[model samples]
Target chain A: MDFTIILQAGIASGTVLLFATLGELFSERAGVLNLGVEGMMLIGAMTAFSTTIATGNPWIGVLAAMLFAGLISQIHAFIVITLQADQVVSGLSLTFLGTGISLVLGEGLSKAGTVSLLPNFSIPLLTLIPIIGKIFFTDQSILVYIGYLLVPLSWYYINHTRPGLHLRAIGEYPSAADALGISVFRQRYFYVFVGGMLAGLAGATISLAVSPGWFSELTTGGQGWIAIGLVIFAQWDPIRAAVGAYAFGALRRLILDIQGPVLLLGFANPFYYNPYLGFFLQMLPYLFTVVVLVIGSREAMRKRIGAPAALGNPYVRGERGK
Target chain B: MKKFLQSEWMSRLIDALLPVFATLAALIIGAVMLLFLGVNPIVAYKALWDGAFGSGNAFAETLVKATPLLLVGLGICISFRGDVINIGGEGQMIIGGILATWIGLTFTGLPGWLAITLALLAGFLGGAIWGGIPGYLKAYFNVNEILSTVMMNAIAVQIMNFMMRGPMLDPIQAAKASKIPQTARLIEAFRLARWSPTRLHLGVLIAVILAILVYILLWRTTLGYRIRAVGMNPLASRYAGIKVPRYIVMSLLLSGAFAGLAGAIQVYGVNYRMITDGSASGFTGNAGFNGIVAALFGQLHPLWSIPASILFGALLVGANQMQRVVQVPSALITALNGLVVVFVVSSEFLRRRRQRQRLAHAKMDDAPPDKTSQPAEASA
Candidate 1:
């Protein structure tokens, strides 16, 4: 195996999942589980693709993607918070709505040629470091660095800041937080919106940083769902979530890498059918997520790991007291 | 008694009209969006209507499309009534199709009636097993059903893809063929014959009968009572000595069975073969999610699910016609469906607001004049 290439691909895939999962961690830790990540990402991908094509600036495209995704998430917040609708259903609906809207809006723009890819940034002196520098810093897009930096920043914000404390409190027990005069609705919406923006940014990273172009349906290929699962595996910690993303990303790369060899062993002349094997191999992360979830929820594992106390529960101010 | 009758009738009228109002509001908003896109909203809607239900053929197509939807919606109604959201209907449907296909292929020489029956049974069992796994997990271990079911759906899709590509590939097709993955067609005799030139088949009748069966089961049986009691309040049911977990699991299994049967009927009655994509294209299990809308719009009652499913089925059928006439994307149909779900779910909030308003009005009516005057003066 070419360790350098494998490492680079791993980092790239990790950046995609990390950006989205980190955003989910923010929303989930704030006590609202936004299942609309996939939808937001889909919208973001379309927005970035369209904006980049129209303006010829990748950064503007990235901004457009985040705004578009965030705007859609506002609808999610409206349903879950303002209307007191079921968050799960609302989030799922947002996804379905976003996917449909993006696909419709994106259909025309999908045929446009690729924009100029985001230029990579290399830190001075850091570029000289051996395998680590090459894998992480050298020739990587700005979004990649930003995605990695978010892990620690999110961790610090969630654990070390007062707003973080309030966020966690609202998620754990909104009524208690309300008694303390925290605006539960405001916090939930705030985090959900912020999470949406991050998710959008993560999505734009795909079109601008990685694929650097437009693509149609399933372009994100269930990465958003994988990010949701990663939040659980990370146990609501941003830094850990990043690690989980990277691990899954690496696993994805490993599966693709072994596809040829494995298929060759199972069937003669596997090179002829490597593409089919690769397609099936792409499903590894999702299958792995189910396995992990099943194992993680086992009695032994449950003792060690816990979900956010208020995950998926809708918070109605007065109802909480009862 | 006269006043009570008037108020009751008024409330019933409002109940009937609320969904229509909600749907109109959603379409108006959607039209405004179309206008922003530089599309003529009126023309687009006309096309959608024409394409979906303008002619006998279009209406038949709509009914054909609605068959799976009606079945899946009824299935979703069953699960939702138990307060368990089984979003994995698409997956369950796919598994049902796979099992039915497997049975049809293996028992090809059997009499037509027996083969059809066996295929349908296999489908139900397949779907039931798929749906039951998540239910069991939730009942036995308190695992979140939403996550489990969603995960299962993803897994099921992958498995379907794998099966079509590998073990279940038709022998006639060369291994190298790039044709879409699908099972062999069921025997002609086993297939549901069209009643006329229209594509509508026996599936619609079966769907209606099943909906009625569901209503009877939910309203008449001891099992139904336990399911409802568990749904209304699991803690209360447990305290009342109901096997809450068992009922929860049973509801999900029954829901899955219905969904699976829908898939089988689609394979035998319509498609005649299991396709790689199981109904994301309005062919099979989009009906599953649509069933959620039907269940909610019907207020989670089986009796209501029939008309609700039909209404949605019409919308779906109409949307296709609208697309052809209006030059708008058919994807708008899904958007409309999402809008319906959003509106229906949000309607509860509107109901609560009205209730609160009524309560405040009643409080003012009950207040003594002097006391009311003093409170009013304080407020002023």
Candidate 2:
């Protein structure tokens, strides 16, 4: 397997996880843990594919996917924020609801053949940087370019901006933030909406750019859950999240490629010899997620820094404690 | 009117009727979906109702379907009550099936009753081990149970796929060109007794008996009390001298055990062997996920889960008939199940608010008559 090609494809696929992991980070930072990312991504994938087929514009498909997924996310917001329901249950049900709605709406889209895909082109001067240029700036999907920009922007926004401070304050100490005139409920809802939109964008990136199609539940393939796990590993930091997402993307691509070759790095490849061993290869990403979570948890314990304090708890205006 | 609304009977009535209301709301939405699909809602629903209950045989099929759901629901009750969300039921069931199948295949010379018991026990042990890993992770390592369980489910699915296509492949099928993934037919002596003219098997009786046993466990026994106590308030339970982590682990272990039992029953009573279409849902029929809905619909009470499982079982079994008659995708049922869960959980807000109001009212009654009463706005 060629290293350059694998890394290139890996970056394109990594953009999907980047968007999803960042979305989940925003939601978790705002103290609303949405376990519905998988469902939302599926909805986004279905909408993007079907809308592009109808509108003949991949951009419109992306926009529609974001809008639809964002709208559905409001259900979780209303249940958890307005009604004070359990976040975990509401998130789980939201996933179910999202999956069901997408399945129903996406019924025939999988077999609808091809539509216009997102534009892909390389940057002029950036391509001259040798290995990094070939992997990062070479004819990549526009979404990949957008992902490159999102990482640092999100990091700066969360760390330096005034509103970013407010976001952190609400998540860490919502009751205190409420007393200081920040509308915790509204901000939580908005952040959850932002999270949903990003998830939709991730789904759109998949259907329109990376691996375009609506293949039912397999379209997202539990990447959403992996994103959630990534958020923990990143400790809610966007830059760290990008690194984890891209590495995971590369690993996922590697697993598929490893099974294809008859020989490995000048040795016999067992995966090629016994195709059944590929099943174990398929388990790596998920197993890696578990390992990542354990490491994140242990680090948090050591550092005494972890998830937002009020992450899974609903904010009541007159609550006694967080 | 206020007094009547505040009565104990009124609370019970609302508790009983809320799930019905949620189910109805979901069905109404599902009907609208059918309309969108270009099928007549009335015609579609008629097909669904008739398919679930039109004949004795159809009803038997519904019960047959409910068996696994009930078994899984029992586990849901145990885990959710212990405040552990065991989404790994899908994985636990597969591992359980694998173990039970192994037992059935190896110990063929034993008598029917003893062999079946040993196989079921093996199934429970396999599930417990599978489930206990996540439980142990959550309890000791501080990992999120939901994410871990989900990961475990994925791992279990791969393991199932590997087992069926690898070692567990029926020797005869392995020789064939098609190589369909399945184990050999379970020796007939080990199979659960089935009534003629219907697919109903003795597993249903076992499930019903387990439901009663679970109810007794949750209410009558100290172990049940400890599990519920941990769920209700782990900190308080710890302060009260309970081994919080141990119970957390036990709850998941027991929860997984029941799901494993369900998987064993499915093999010994329903399918007569382990098989797969290369996906967890293919073999488990999504019963692992559906059981969560049943548990919620039953108000998280073990005994109430019986009817809840049956109701969902009807929806699943009848969806096939609905699909045939109306040409609407059976996926509509999955969507409806999601809607029902959403509604059921959202309705909980109303119950909680009313409960708080009742407590406030009780406090008000104890106050002196001369003090004017103020409305408790905690409902907000």
Candidate 3:
């Protein structure tokens, strides 16, 4: 495998998680755990795929995807905030609904034929660098560059800004935030919806940029949940989450990049002849996730700092000790 | 009307009816979606019901669909009662099926009943181990089972693909170079006895019996009480001398066992060969996830899930009939089922609020007689 090429692809794929992790981070900060990341991404991917196909414009595709995803997220916000439904159940239902609808629509859109993939452009001097620039700064989609801006922007927004503090307060103790005149409901709704939109854009990153077409339940191949996992792995910090996402992305691509050579050279020996070795390698991403989750959370589970104390609780006005 | 509304039986009746109402609302929403696609709602629904329950053949097919669902849904009820969500049912079911397939193929020397029983037990163990992982994780380390279980589903899928394409691949098919992923057909002695003409097998009876057993286990047994208590309040259970974590793990084991049995039954009874149908769904045919939908729609009761699974099963079988006649894709069932789940999840919250309201009303109704008479006396 070409190390630079692997890094380039891994960083590009990692940007998908960057958008979703940042979105989930913001939502969790505002005390809403939106488990519908997979669903929203599928909806975004489907919409973006068809829209880009119709207009032949990837930018329009991304925007439409974000808008549709944001709209769908409202269903979640209303169920969680207004109806006071269980966040997990509501989020799961959102996923089921999103995946089902996306597949149904994707059948028609995929029949519309593939659209032009998102264009990629490289920086002049950065592109000239031997390996480092090739992996990080050059030869990535515009979305990856946007994701670059987002990592620092989200960190600054959460730590240095006024609303960010309120967001933290709401997540930690909604009653206290309410006492301080923060509309916990409004803030949660805003963040969850924004998170959904980001998930949508991330979906478009798959369809319009990453894999470059719509596939059934394609976003669910562990990306959304990985983002959700990264949220916890990062302890809800955007920068740490980015690190986790990139590492996972690299790991996800590593096996694929090396499998061809390994198979041809019989490097894996007796197992090399096994046709199913590919499936075992496919298990790496998920197995690694379980390992990371167990180890990362071995000691301080909930007491881990940066965990939004009221993360999954629905904020009710004047409710004591909720 | 006022008297009927005020009657004590009314509340009980409403509790029973809410799920029905939710199911209807879900179907109606599905109908509207159909309308948008230029199909008449009346025609589509009529076709659905006819295909599901219209004849003996359809009912038999519906039974096939409902069997796994009932088993899996009941499993869901068991785990949820202990406050553990076992979303790993898909993986559990697949592993169970694979193990059962192996057992049936390897243990052919045994008698029929013994062979089936051994295979089923192996299946149960496979699922129990799979489900227990998340249970143990949640109990000891507080690893979120939801994340773990969902991730496990993907892993399970790969494992299934590997087994089918590699070690478990039918030797005959391998020699022929067939790409179809499946095991060799089970030995005839191990095949489940079918009620002729109707494809119904003994698995339906097992599913029904298990449903009752789960209901009894949940409500009549001490284990059930402990599980429910832990689910209701872990702190209170701890105070009352219950080991919350133990029950949590046990709940998941029993849950996974039930789901594993479902998969084993599917292999031994319905499909007779373990294979993927090549859809976007996993080998479990969405049964693991859909069982959650059924359990939710049934209000998480084992008994209620029977009918809930039937309704969902009918939708699946009937959707095929509907597709034949009305040309609406059967895939729409997933979306329709998703809508039902959305409604059902929210409706349960509404049901709880109404129960609270009813209790408050009863308190007002039983208020001091003197206070009640005072209002009349003051009016006079």
Candidate 4:
């Protein structure tokens, strides 16, 4: 396997996951666990594909995708925040709603196959640089740079700003935050909206930047779940989340590059003749997620891991103290 | 007697009307979407109804679809009433099918009745094992059951995929033929005999019997009392000397067993072989999740769950017809299911609000009498 091709795929996948995980980080920090990221991403991918095909402007399509996903996720926020619905159920329902809606809307568009791919941006000096610059900065869509930029920007907004502190406080203890006159509802609404928009952008990256095509049921294949797991692996830190995404992305690419293996020491190795070993390897992320969750549940591991304190709990105004 | 009749009638009316109301509201929402799609909502719904229940065959299809749902829904009811969210029904069902297939393949010489019984037992044990893991974790480690169960589902899917593609693959098919990964079909006698022109089997009767048994297990037994008590308030139950953790584990095990039985019935009655990628649609097209919706709509009661499963089954059958007749997506059914769940959950809050309003009005009416009494007491 060529190092450069592997590097390219890694960067591309990492860009998609980074955007999704960063968005999820914001939502969780605001005390909302959005399990519907996959749904949002799927909606985003479909919208991006359709809009880009219709308008022939990848940028406009990306914008449309973000707005579409954000608007849909608003329903989730409305139920969880306003109606005090269970967050997990609301999130699961959001996925069903999003997937159902996208399939209905995207069916015709997918059949048409009119999606136009986004053009790559190349910087002269950066393109000439060695492996590091080639993988990170050159020969990628503008959105890749945008995704990279979002990491630190998200970190700043979540750690240094007043709104950030309030968001953290709401996640840690919504009652205390409400008592301090920070509107938990407004903060949650804002973060959820922002999270939805980012998720939309992440979906757009898949359709517009990475593949730039419309394929039915191809938009989501559990990358959203991986992004959620990345948020946990990063301990809710945005920058580290980006790193985790890149690592997962690299592992995925490495597995794809491995070929021609038929060594069997036992009676018969299942992997020796199986052509679908590649597909099984693709499932590594989910396996990793389960392993991390099991580890995270341990008392010693939990102390080291960071999760939003009030995550999945509804916050009502008058019921703050109680 | 008149007052008692009125109260009883009103209670029954509310109980019956709530699910219908929720279902109607969900349909209205779906209809609005259909209108947006430029399809006539009335025509679509009529198509759906005709598809699900128009003829003997269609009705049979609905019943067959509802069989697994009935089993899973009953399980959901039992677990949910005991305050355990057993989302792993799909996984348990898969494990059940796997175990049944294994037994059916290995013990070919056994008599039909004994073989079938053994298969069913294997299914129950398989599901119990799958579900009991999360139960043990939740009971002992304080692990969140929702996350743990969801994770187990993914693991079960992988395990099922591995078995179907690897060890359990049928030997008759050619290597390059792209055969469906399934085991050999069960012997004829071991299979469910067709009772009518339709494909409804004796398994439906088995489902009904299990439902009644679940009802008895949840409402009649001392163990049932302990489960309910723990569900109401674990701390209170603990103070009352109930082993809350044991009940949690036991309830989950029972839930899994019912789910496993559903899978076993599916294999022996319908599919007759374990298909590869059997769970691609996730829990055989989300029968388990829909079972949750059914259980909730049925108010977490086994007796009510039978009708609820039938209704959901009709919806499934109808959605397929609606897709063919009106050219609308079948996913509208899923959307409708979600809407039903949302509305049903919301009704509880609405009832609470109404109760609070009535209490406030009663207090307001008694305010002047209380004020006058307070003045008299002060003078005295």
Candidate 5:
């Protein structure tokens, strides 16, 4: 019911999704639909959690997470890009692998006791503004602040930069890009590695800031998948993805925030009130994801809006496909 | 060029050997990982092998684990071959189990065969419906099956949780103290009969028969041809006057039914009661994901999934035993399974590359003599 409270919390929590969506945005734009965002996120989360615990520095944890995840994503890049395996299968298996590896490595970190999560702070100049400042800029985690800067930076990078154009060109028509002397394979590998590192950072945000600490397959609760969905829902646009992520974050927060009142309000009939009514709240975000995906897909297909032309297919020079 | 990877027979040979080589390579990688983790790889593997296949009892457990995997993998084969990824097997399995549990609990005094048949049918139908939702969306609305299926999984889990805790709470447990999420034991007549020593039940037979059935349905039937044709080239299939969407729906439905059967049989044959620990893994044992791994290892063939599932089953059983003896967490096995999947998929990639190379070589060789055949071969 408190709009500001929900908005603040949504921005704080949605940073995880924003990072993931941005990461996926890069990979998809490069024409390699890396579905292993979830996997990379998990690896990042585990590395960040454990590293932060060991080194007592959240920044160190973030760096390791990105490094480990980016390094691991080479396996995916090898299979999908260089080897030309099915991207979806490779991505799913990467997730399965990532989840397994992270959990195996992270099992002891959580039980090793409480670890320091990245704390929130407000900018002095920005916090001094009116109601706008309080709603938009106050007391946010460093990740959320980074996400805010990331939005415009990504937008500019994707739409304005020379390298961004080349990335887009390769994704849309690798053969044409190859004809133009662009190394489609190298560019794809570059983006996949970069995207994977971002995904790792997203996972670090979850462990170090969002949820704090680590749990077995903790990110498996569909956030990574939702982040992938956010890419589509954003029509592969950066700013749009940011809005979508925050909106989704708000929706995710609704599950925890609404258990008491929203259900009671939605089901006005007294007979519908059950003690376990709150259990259905857990299903909200997933259901929302499906609904959003359907609509996003409908829009994308209807208008042929914003997807890269050769999104899921791997490129093999001089090889014909059925 | 030394006849390297040439000829269709040679390609087939590689296809057959690829999985074995991949499995070995993955095991080697796993061994390296174990060594890095400060464990003795040989001793650990010995424990794993002994645990999975050492004795008659262990072998029986492997069969038991393989049963559900084989069924689900076969189901996934249908969907994957049709180019529709039905990742919602976990949801399908959960819904199917609940349906079977309901049938077992609701119906009484019926003959055992009739009861079991009805229960199985209910489970299959439940899973089919659960799967059909994504299928229908993909067919009519162009929705992504993978994401839709994932969403369906979440909804399915919530539904199971609500039902189990609310109305379906084992009446006996309702009467007593209960923290564990479960239903009361099913009626005695509905329980699957087990063999004396192995304790493996009728589900193994069902799995074998269904595998054959899937193989036949995929290769022998016209529906199968249409599905394959659609999967190969939807635009071409559409041009050829095939209804592409229908095949997509059919594949997903069939896949869901098989997954549902896996769930139903697990309740009847192994667990004997419908229970969940409020996590997808606890109820489905990650069988949904494992099934995908099996299907991939099997080269998407139902017949091959039998051995693939068995191999996966052995790994799981072995890993559990290894965990107990070596003090390694069972999570390591999951990571190991992921490793196997990656290796198998990568091997598939290499195989395809080699096939492409062979085709290119063959084209060049025939270039001078086969001017007339060039166009025909290009299309073929």
Candidate 6:
């Protein structure tokens, strides 16, 4: 029950959430709410695992996962962007489609023993900074290191870059952006694809790096839904999303580990004595998501901050009121 | 031929047949998937068709499967019509089942009819509570109902797992080495009335009746009108003094109530005791999701959902037989269901485009100076 060990595993698992939350953030910021994160993640995990098994290369597996998930996302983009369908229903269907396709294709891949995993290494000097280095820079997966780079890079991209501003403009005011010669439809499609690729990356992170296997739907569990919840909690900011993802990842690790000990704080652990009680413990992540949503909603009310203005609305050129 | 294609009757015909085309397109894609799986698509489909409609008993089983879908679809009709998407059907159904099972188990001595009625009411109440929380959040706090409902589903799954393996585990089963997570057999007197030599029960009749009731509630009643009006445009409905938030909450509540009722019927009629395989879909058979497909196929009309449910129910029932006959995974039906939803929703744009074109054509003929007609093609 070393606290440092829990935090280390937490950071690794949190990378998975980081990818998913950031992906969803990009989609929602672009004014298209793609709720197909769960489905896309499943597709990613299946593709990554199956490809790694066949190709003997985890890097290729990761790329295939991202491409396949991104490709699947086009169905959603076409429906919501080009056809002007309800984003919610179309996204839900995408999830069903992704899950079904993966389940059918990844049917027996669960028993396909093991494959080469993504490289894990520690930074030379950073690992000497006591507690911070041990937890942050210790022997972690390459994807985890990439996650470290992505958070700051994403924050800078969305806030400082000209393209970032265009992304924001199209999401907040598509008509105005369209008038400025930025194709709202094209940008929306691209952002949605970016979201899907990130979601796929998150899935690949799980099967190839983090937990390193597929157990069907349980591979992602409800982490995709949690990432969606985190996006709201993060106020669509990459920094805030990263903080929330790491905290949630730690909480998940705590729940899983808490059940293993026979004694806790000088008393018997009820979870250990009665394994059924662990079911309630497993519910913490989902229940916490609901709680976080309430807090996010209330805070947004108090602060008067909110989602992108045009979020969830299909942007049609010449349409009134955008 | 162009003029004939543009005729009003032809447009009406196309509108009516759009869903059929979408379904056919999905099945075609499914056939391709079957081909990739190294199975003969025609033989597999024939086996599916025979399994679904081959015998009287099979048809009866299909009806039995349709019972839950129809019940859940009825709820989807109400919620979606109100513009409040209720993805919490799985959780709501589980909560409803827990309540209904508790009542049936506790009141074994009560009169059969009264016990059944009370259990059903309890189920409805449980689902309403589960659904109303998200509805209230969405209305007042501006929380996204989709995310909250999904979280609620996960929460509900844990609760169900807890109750089944702990409090609800049958005493006899608990003593065995393989302690299967299930409840005590619901008293025989309280079980749904089954038909002779068939699994069909009174639950089917109740589902059919409720569909008509939901139809009337949505179209013929003031309450129904307000729900639909709010769905169409909440701001306008609010300005018209419709109490927009209340209708939103009511729609979700009613929707959840229907799914809850389905849960009760499933225990009382089909299984006679609630059971679980440590997963939400294992207990629900994914009816909560399939019901959405049924409702969409029905054009969000409750009455239409009757046939839609039966159709999907046939697919589900026949998939089992197809799995056995062709060695193809039953997961194909789920994928096909997703494809249908995608196609059906995508086709809506085509329908709207056609309607807009017709209006533009009519205005051009009626009033040559109209300005709106010029931009119609550009917009399309």
**Clashes by residue pair, model 2:** none
Model 1 spans with C-alpha error above 4 angstroms:
A122-131, A260-280, A299-301, A318-322, B1-6, B175-180, B277-285, B358-380
**lDDT tens per residue, model 4, A130-227:** 88778877778888878778888889988999988999999998988888999999999989999899899989998887766656455666677778
lDDT of 4 at A133: 75
Q: What digit string (tens of lDDT, one per residue) describes model 6 on residues A1-322?
A: 6778789889999999999999999999999999899999999999999999999999999999999999999999999999999999999999989998988898888899999999999999999998899999999999999999999999999999999999999999999999999999999999999999999999999999989888998999989989999999999999999999999998998888888788887788877846577888888898899889999989988999889999999998998997
lDDT of 5 by residue, B232-252 (tens): 899999999999999999999
Model 4: DockQ score: 0.32
Docking model 5 quality class: medium
RMSD of each: 3.3, 1.9, 3.1, 4.5, 3.7, 2.0
Give the clashing pairs for model 3.
none
Evaluation by lDDT, superior candidate among 4 and 5:
5
List residue ranges in candidate 6 displaced over 4 A. Answer: B368-380
List fnat, each candidate: 0.42, 0.65, 0.64, 0.17, 0.73, 0.81
**lDDT scores for all predictions?**
0.79, 0.91, 0.85, 0.79, 0.86, 0.92
Indicate whether candidate 4 or candidate 6 has the larger lDDT.
6
lDDT of 3 by residue, B1-380 (tens): 97787577997888788877877888888888888879998999999999999999899999889988999899899898888888888888988998999999888798999889898898889889888888898898877888888888788888888888888888887888566888899988897889988889999998999889999999999999999999999999999999999999999888888888888988999888898753215467888888888888887899899999999999989998998999887777888887887887777777778787778778868986554355544767
Candidate scoring better on TM-score of 2 and 3: 2
**lDDT by residue (tens digit), candidate 3, A244-309:** 888887887776776655443434543443457778888888888888787667634555565689
Best by lDDT: 6
Interface RMSD measured for model 2: 0.8
* Docking quality (DockQ) for each candidate: 0.51, 0.79, 0.64, 0.32, 0.75, 0.83
Clashes of each: 11, 0, 0, 0, 0, 0
TM-score, model 2, chain B versus true chain B: 0.95
* Model 2 misplaced stretches (Cα beyond 4 Å): B371-380
Identify the runs in model 3 with alpha carbons over 4 angstroms from their true place: A128-130, A262-274, B277-282, B369-380
lDDT of 2 by residue, B205-318 (tens): 999999999999999999999999999999999999999999989999999899998899999999999988767888799888888889988988989999999999999888
Best candidate according to DockQ: 6
